[model samples]
Target: MANIPAFKLNDGNEIPSFGFGVFQIPADGTTYKAVSDALKLGYRHIDTAAAYFNEQEVGKAINDSGIPRDQIWVTSKMWLQDYAYEDAKKAIDTSLNKLGLDYMDLYLLHQPYGKVDEAWRALEEAQKAGKIRSIGVSNMSPKLWKKWAPSFNVTPAVNQVEFNPYFQQQELRDVLADSHVALEAWAPLGEGNQDLFNEPVLKSLAEKYGKDVGQIILRYEHQLGVIVFPKSVHEARIKSNAEIFDFELTSDEMDALRKLDKGKGMHDPDAPGVADTLLNAFDIHAND
Candidate 1:
């Protein structure tokens, strides 16, 4: 196994450059098996959430994998319904109980809406209580981040967003850069969008590096200092996604890939004429 690089967060904690994501992993034995397999394959970082409803399975995998709790980095999130101060705290307890862990490496506000300010306060309390090591947000726009960043004594350590070559968030990235906040890519492979896999430049680069187009994209983001959580149920891809540390992309190649950014989200939060659907999409029911 190769040594994956680590990024130092503003809070002084180090995060693995790559992690395994359990976004839609069913809360069954399959989830447990997949996560355990990832750990055995040298993945120390695992990203999950209360809304995912599979934290228990993730916990079971870690406990059964024979890895020390401190040797692994576990991250989970607070859903919208649990955004109030009291609810958020309870949610953390529920998550910890579900995962059977003493603490979380990082905990994030799952979205920008609902009672986020109150939820953020809960995150602060959790940090103070040692329930979570670092605090951050997910899917928060730069506007929201600016308004919220000043309110906390502890600055955000990270911002998880949908980042891929086609949807490179340069503006948000710049804002986070100024605050020393690290960025994490959720849909790093564009949610398995086939069009991205067929891009000419990616194909060319894949051939040059003797890697798949997905590998090329992952490497590009890695060079840009964005932590990526590429989800895969397949074992081969699980290993391939982590094999990116051995090579580097040149400046010209990086620029060519950057050109693929269309400046709009492939998975837009505000899709036109779908307000109800969009709102529902981020609702708690979607997770259930």
Candidate 2:
């Protein structure tokens, strides 16, 4: 297997450029097997969320994999219910206990709203106390970050958002770039949108490279310096997603993919009050 590169965080910590995401991994023994399989396939980084309700499964997989703790990178996020300072602290401890780890490689506030300032403060305190190595936010709009950033003692090291060829998030990318915060892409494959799979440009490039269209898309994103975590349950697809290191996308191919941007987001941020109502009404957390 080709080695994946690591990106240096603003705090000087390193994260694997390619990681495995367990966003919708079932909260059961299946999660354990899937994660263990990924680690055995040479993936050092694993991203999960409390909302996934499989932290314990992920932890069990890591522990049973027999990999040394320091060699593995584990990331987890806090949900909105735990946004208060004390509550967030308790959440972190619960995550640690569930993960069976002394410290987390990365911990992010899962959304942009709901006592976010308090959550950020708690993350900062966790870092100071050696419970977490790096801290960031997810699904945050630039406008939200602009209002929230000034209140922080620590700048966010990353912002996880929905990104793909169809929704490149150019404006948010620019804002994050200026702040020196890395952008991490969730749903990097557009949640398996068939249109993306059938794109002529991607098809041509995939044919040229003798790889799948998904590989071409991933290569493009890596070249653009956006971190990606494309999830998979099938062992073949899991292996294929990590095969991005073998090829490179040319400048023209990059440009072709860039033109596909529709300038819209598929997911909405769950801010407090009305935002939560909207998100709940739409069943934002429901698996598609």
Candidate 3:
């Protein structure tokens, strides 16, 4: 098993350096098998969300794998439909029930919109009640963070966002640093975009390090102290993603990767009418 390093959060909780992400993965035997394989291959952390509709399968995989719940880290998120304080409270319990877990290692607001302050308060209360170990938000920009952070009685422990070589949100990263919030990267591989995979600099680094381009990018993010979780349903790819801890990226190589930033992410959290679109489009219970 790989001894993945853990990064301590501002709240003094330790999160694994790498994890397995379950986004856009179907909630079926496939999810169960993929998660079971990841655990067997040494992934101790698993990320899922209400929107993904796979919490039940993820929980079952963890349980059936016979891994002690304490040895595995589980994270889930609250969707927009349940952003009201009371609704958020119910949503947290719903997620916990769906995952078949008593407490979540981390629970995040799935988006920056809706009743964030109310929803966050609910998260804080849950933490105090021992329902969640840590509480945070995702897809939140620095501007949105600043506007609401002061009102938070319990500061966010992690801020997950789309961070990759192609779209490094340096400004938000800096803000997160100042706030002592850990940056958890969601799409660390640029969603397998051909443009990112075909970059000459990344290819050169991959050849030099005896790794694939994906490994080079993951290693770079690991070197920058960012938390990364790459999603892949394939068994070979899941095993390959965990091979990053064996190597290190040099300062020059890291710099080269930084220069590939396009100064913008593929998704804009601040885009006009984004809240309205997301709120109405996603139904976490739709699959049921």
Specify the highest-TM-score model's number. 3
- Give the Å error, residue 81, model 3: 0.6
lDDT of 1 by residue, 60-139 (tens): 99999999888898999887777878878888888899999999999998876767788888888889999999999988
In the range 170-263, model 3's lDDT, one tens digit per residue, is: 9998898887899999899999999999999999989998999999999899988889999999999999988987788888878888999998
TM-score of each: 0.94, 0.94, 0.98
Query: Ten residues in a row with the worst lDDT in model 2?
Result: 279-288
53 in model 2: Cα distance from truth in Å?
A: 0.1
Of candidates 3 and 2, the better by TM-score: 3
| Model 3 global lDDT (CA atoms, 0 to 1) | 0.92
lDDT of 3 at 82: 93
Per-residue alpha-carbon lDDT of model 2 for 87-166, expressed as tens digits? Answer: 88898998998898899999998877778888889999999999999999988887877878868999999999999999
Between which residue pairs do clashes occur in model 2? Answer: none
lDDT ranking from best to worst? 3, 2, 1
Instruction: Name the candidate that leads on lDDT.
Output: 3
List residue ranges in candidate 3 displaced over 4 A.
Answer: 286-288
Name the regions of candidate 2 deviating beyond 4 angstroms: 270-274, 278-288
lDDT (C-alpha, whole model) for all candidates: 0.87, 0.87, 0.92
**TM-score quality measure for candidate 1:** 0.94
